[model samples]
Target: MLLRKLVPVFALSLASAGVSADRLKPEDAVEYRQSAFRLMSFQLGVLNPLHRRQAYDDEAFVYRAETLSRLAELALEGFTEDSKGQQSRTQARMWDEREAFETRLREFAETTAQMAERSAAGDSRATRDLFRQTLQSCKSCHDRYRIE
Candidate 1:
């Protein structure tokens, strides 16, 4: 399929770009971050019902968790100084308190990574716990750093 071929090429381009603040436009950063978050939310939303029903599709859950972990890692890169003035839900306080925001982002990335590892290892209980923690981390960060 065209998609199968293009995906690798697209990924190669992104990898070669080694995206940095200087390389990203403000609007592009906003779009990139928003897209990453939306994709992550979609993965979590799927996982949520499965977790609640205690129905584990082992391979699917691992796939979603791995996707979420990758997205979490990519998400923070969108918060460039250039993106501050863009029309977005990101709070000024997030940019103002850069250290704290970065810390929270790091924690989120770590949590998602753990969730993926647990899922892959067939540790359902720990995966569920990490899922809850990941959701809580989103709420906690949103409360402080995102505008409604």
Candidate 2:
């Protein structure tokens, strides 16, 4: 019985490891960009509804904040390398604006972290403010780096 349970668990772990080992190639840039954009949009969608509420579940806020942080990190990573095609949505000035993009990404991450911390501390007002600021950073970066 123990062996049976252990075998299935081991197989599942191996399967997941194999799936994760498939690195993103330049050919996959479009899909990766879309996926990352969707994640950011989803996180912001959640925050939009919560802005009017005075109090929100701390755990929920933290979860969303973490998601935003991860999305920002992924956005930075996605732009690190070149795509296979010449018609990418990435801006032509990305190479020149690299430093500015990195700064904005870091600011988004820091603001999201602050939001998480404030939410955990039960500071709704601060959390809301930080969330808005983080959203603005995301918008600014997208406006400059993202073609659409």
Candidate 3:
């Protein structure tokens, strides 16, 4: 019982040991946020063809969905401080409408997480639907808050 109690405390401490989000330098935050999106894109590439029936890699689909969920979370963390740099596609509106930006990221993460759960259960239909919802969330945010 003591070990079990200690284990919970230890786990919480370990989880909280990650670099504080606000400690990131502006350029580092901007670069990491963009990199997180790229990672999500690569993971999506793994799922898309299989999802479209061009491939039958069910295991890859599940793995990619799980990865995308984590990537969404990472993206959220990276965007914690709106540090749009010279090379960033993020719009000034992101900081201007900060709460809305956060809402979009949260929705994306939630939907992607649902997709991951459905993919793990081998439910292609639900996975595909949730995947679309997650992408729609991305597109909606990009439309409003990203620049080409």
- TM per prediction: 0.82, 0.74, 0.79
- Residue-level error in angstroms, candidate 1, position 101: 1.1
How does each model score on lDDT? 0.78, 0.68, 0.71
Best prediction by TM-score: 1
- All candidates in order of lDDT, best leading: 1, 3, 2
- Report how far off residue 126 is in candidate 2 (Å): 1.5
Tens digit of per-residue lDDT, candidate 2, span 1-148: 1223322222122224454313667657556756877898898777777766645445667668767776765655555455635467778787677788777776776688678678878888888788778767877877888888
Off by over 4 Å in 2: 1-23, 84-86
Give a tens-digit lDDT track for model 1, residues 12-90: 2223567655677989999989998999999989888878876443666766876877787678778878888899999
Q: Clash totals for all models, in order?
A: 0, 0, 0
What's the distance in Å from true for residue 88, model 3?
1.4
